[model samples]
Target: ENFFDFCIHSSGESEIKIKLFFISWHPLIVPIDEIYANETGTLTVCRFYTKGSLKDYIHQTKPTNSAYWKRYGRKSLSRVCDLNQIKNFGRQILEALNFIYDNGLVYGHLHSGNILFDLDQALPIKLLVGFVYNLYF
Candidate 1:
């Protein structure tokens, strides 16, 4: 079965000041694999996680579990998680947040949607993408 493999997440405010931060690698931060630009703004490319974002995981599985991706996608990629799994996820989120703060940066946007789960791993499974990444300040 086919899954949602790619998508372009758009933001209105184009901050050209962002630079330098994308070069380094961090376990909790989603690495900028490539960046595409246009007249309006620029968009960064990262892996399309099989399990998708944490927001999708929660919203899709709860209640009736009717979402197409949840229902028809490969069951192996997603699982019936346990309490300890949740606690582990929480710990990773904190680690990501700590990394941001330690670098003297503030992540203004923090939410479930900003966090992603990569059931198919190249790196750690959980990662943060949405951060106030204006590094050229």
Candidate 2:
């Protein structure tokens, strides 16, 4: 449930958006400026700016079938997906996995909660978060 959240900018100058993640592996996370660990607390928190997560793209829609009804129960937060979208999503995920594999790292956490996306740019990109287990090649 604990994931990246945008940080509030207190500076008067134009500030870049920042995100915070707790107890994360440095390699798996996106490029970060700093990693601060609190010695007084048992949990470790990491602060960095990320494009954002796939959760931003989620939108509520009416269910169209029994399967959707069962899965979503009337109203669904899952947006209407087309074949191209599904294919693109699959390709993005595959590319992410390939990148990890090429870097001699294997990601064991593959789930919706771990999948993050950047849809604001001209060409949207997806990333996998929550590196609970990673194996080196």
Candidate 3:
């Protein structure tokens, strides 16, 4: 709950935005009112998202189930995807980290599951980047 609360308030400031921009270029890092909670301290109201984490997308690939690759099989899907896409993903992650580090904050937990896919957009990566940007910055 504390983490979620921190994320909510953290995403609301301009300073946080600058910090986020420096850390991760990825927009998914932006915080959202995806999840909400009631706390016991002075800050009783909190908001966050329960939708899911990025790790879900990264770990989608499974040895037995090649179908998972359709979503995020980094290697096996190379035939259809170019190196640029892969590089972009990596860059986005680094940007996110940079934002966290620049602000003296630590993501603490990171994985493919934490990364999420935005199905509504033509480019999911762009959408996620925007989402994260709005949330934290």
Candidate 4:
């Protein structure tokens, strides 16, 4: 259903690979949400975006020549959107970026996959430059 539901209903999720996923704040940036963890690790949760990531929203197919082809995989999907929707998305992006920069904070990891269409609360700052561009490039 929704990202929140997905995270909560993940059954038995237990991992803490991404550090940022645990502690984050700000309206534009995905916030560190609810959960419990122990010595094993944290329940890393990224909200389920109905709109998906910006890359997912735009690209019809995975990048064939991309080094991350293995990760993105090869798939054909259809996108449904209009110019006005695109414009609104752009505005929201700018607002998010401004918020990050204004706070003297940097989005260490910036990429299409790093950006989700629904920017309410889920996912945030991360590592790996290649993993950065690699995630959704």
Q: What is the TM-score of each candidate against the true structure?
A: 0.54, 0.48, 0.40, 0.44
Per-residue lDDT of 29 in model 2: 44
Query: lDDT per residue, candidate 2, 49-100, as tens digits?
Result: 2544444345332222236345445454567668997787777777766765
- Candidates in descending TM-score order: 1, 2, 4, 3
Q: Write the per-residue lDDT of candidate 4 for residues 31-110, one digit (tens) a residue.
A: 55454554333443554445556665466534332454533555635577689776766666667665544543344456
What is the overall TM-score of model 4 with all chains considered together? 0.44
Task: Score candidate 2 by lDDT.
Answer: 0.42
lDDT (CA) per prediction:
0.54, 0.42, 0.44, 0.45
What is the lDDT, from 0 to 100, of the residue 84 in candidate 2? 92
Where does model 1 exceed 4 Å of error?
1-24, 35-43, 61-81, 120-124, 133-137
Candidate 1 local lDDT, 1-137, one digit each (tens): 11111111232233222431442267778777666554433456676665667766755543234666665457624446689777878887788776766664456577766787664564434555443443223
In candidate 1 the C-alpha lDDT for residue 48 amounts to 65
Which 10-residue window of candidate 1 scores lowest in summed lDDT? 1-10
Model 3 misplaced stretches (Cα beyond 4 Å): 1-26, 34-81, 119-137
Q: Which candidate should be chosen as best, given TM-score against the real structure?
A: 1
Comparing 1 and 4 on lDDT, the stronger one: 1
Error of 2 at 93 (Å): 1.2
Candidate with the greatest lDDT versus the true structure: 1
